[model samples]
Target: MLKLDHITVVPPTLAEGVRHVQDCLDIEVPFGTRHEYMGTHNHRLQLGDGIYLEIVAFDPDGISPRHARWFGLDDQKTVRSNWDAGRRLRGWVASTNDLRSVLAKHGEIFGTEVPLPPENPVFAFAIPKDGSLPLDGAAPSLIDRRGVPVSSEKIPDRGAVFRSMTLEHPEPEAIERLYEELEIDHPPRVVTGTEVRYRAEIETPSGLKELT
Candidate 1:
């Protein structure tokens, strides 16, 4: 079954992105090696419950763009914005084993799957070359690195664990249908907003804290 995987943070540079997450979450995050094929490198922070947050950025010195690089900042205005001023939450990714079939069923909901390098062993979803997906110009792209996701292992949860994740969106029925199409395990509860908001209940030393 498909599941809500992780979220992405797009900063203009890897160092800056890592710093941003560290400041907001008040934790230490480590820089990971580069995905040569994607022309990007990242840092990871664990958010408990097999979920993580990734801070990613293009490698300025790399020669080619990675196949699944999300966040369309190729243009001057987008670049100037620096992936939505770095304050935006960007987007989320869903993962499934049967990606090919899933895409065939809901091809209209997203863009083409960018082929990752064989060495990288993952696939991803991003806006189509024609710019579909109604991203509001600030969403980060969705990526699924094959095997186990990096965040599942690298980031330490300290003492916290995710109890549940709740998503808010308009057109509850339609969104519910989309999740059903993907075979996602969690059934999203419908709300009034066009944007997706995540509410996670985490266990800490003090007590359970609701993180939004």
Candidate 2:
């Protein structure tokens, strides 16, 4: 079975991404390591359960990847455009024990499963080799974590708990089937829109707030 592991917030830059969380939620997000393989870095925050939040962006200092970078960060202009529009919650990742099974079932629609180094200990079914983010980045990235520290043990909590997460896409039926296939609870909503949008309601020290 698959479970929601974390939500990814892709900003134009890591600094701006961190600032958005601080400005909007007034919480300090701890810096996570640089994903050297993907040429990206992130700041992390705990949101109760085994789930967390990652604010990811292209690492300005990291070397370029031989293949297309994950999360569509390969296109600088697109990243800037999204940032210019506003700080929005972009995508999420799901974790499963049987990674191969999940891939075998929906690899084509989900994307290619690229195995990371043993030291890094993650198997990412990122955007397809052609580099198209499925459903315009609304589809949750599939992951298989190997012997990694749990979020509760690794990330320091700053008094925030996830209340719910709502995803919106132009065509919800396809996504609904995907979610059902993966066993996602309280699945995303379908709406008449051009883009996939998401909002995560989190309870913080300042009461409940939406992470958009």
Candidate 3:
């Protein structure tokens, strides 16, 4: 039901998020767009092959949403803790065609579908009620773009190409089973670890680099 969409870095603010990504990738990602409905904004960079990296954070100047913001931006304490722990490349998102059916079967893990923009919605995203990472980032976030292609020319391309992604979870077996059930194309490889985290290898203009 889903395919690899993009990876993400959730920071407390846009400025911090940009710095983190720039320091790691050795390139500046151009501003992507703002989420007026979610009260957040982001910077994006293409990782080649239609994949991209997103640095999203809460927009202090934007109006607060009725519900919590996505990517756990509402919880700055945890976001800061994770960032301080060197978990910059925090999570990943998956794009799907049948978001409704997928959520129907796995709402507990993937969360409910929320049509974005509040007005003239163009995309729908799966966000938990508390607006937390899907399974605390153990599982990838789900997005339904209403048949739109995942790869886009809009995002910046600095000659960065994705190589591989490895997801670390304490219960690797459980996460692996979930990925199999979801039939996620290009899903990250699961490995046993003390905590749920993500790491990716990307080929950049400067050479191979790891984003975490």
Model 3: how large is the Cα RMSD against the reference?
1.2
- TM-score for each predicted model, relative to the true structure: 0.70, 0.89, 0.96
Error of 2 at 206 (Å): 1.2
- Sorted on lDDT, best first, the list reads 3, 2, 1
Candidate 3's C-alpha runs over 4 A off are none
Q: lDDT for each of the candidates? A: 0.55, 0.76, 0.86
> For residues 3-68, what per-residue lDDT tens digits would candidate 1 score against the true structure?
666665666777766665555554556776687765667776566657676666667776466343
On residues 15-98, what C-alpha lDDT tens digit does candidate 3 reach at each position? 888887778778888999888888899999888777889999888888899877888889889999988887777899999888
Estimate, for each residue in 1-212, the C-alpha lDDT of model 2 and write its tens digit: 67788888888888888888887678879998888877888888999878899998889899777777777788778878877776357877777777778778777766776777424645645556755556566677777775463557667789889888777777777777778877865555555555677888889999888888
Q: What RMSD does each model have against the real structure?
A: 4.2, 2.2, 1.2
Ranking by TM-score: 3, 2, 1
Best by lDDT: 3
Please give the clash total of every predicted structure, in order: 1, 1, 2
Index of the highest-TM-score prediction = 3
Residue 93, candidate 1: Cα error in Å is 1.7
Worst 10 residues of 1 by lDDT: 132-141
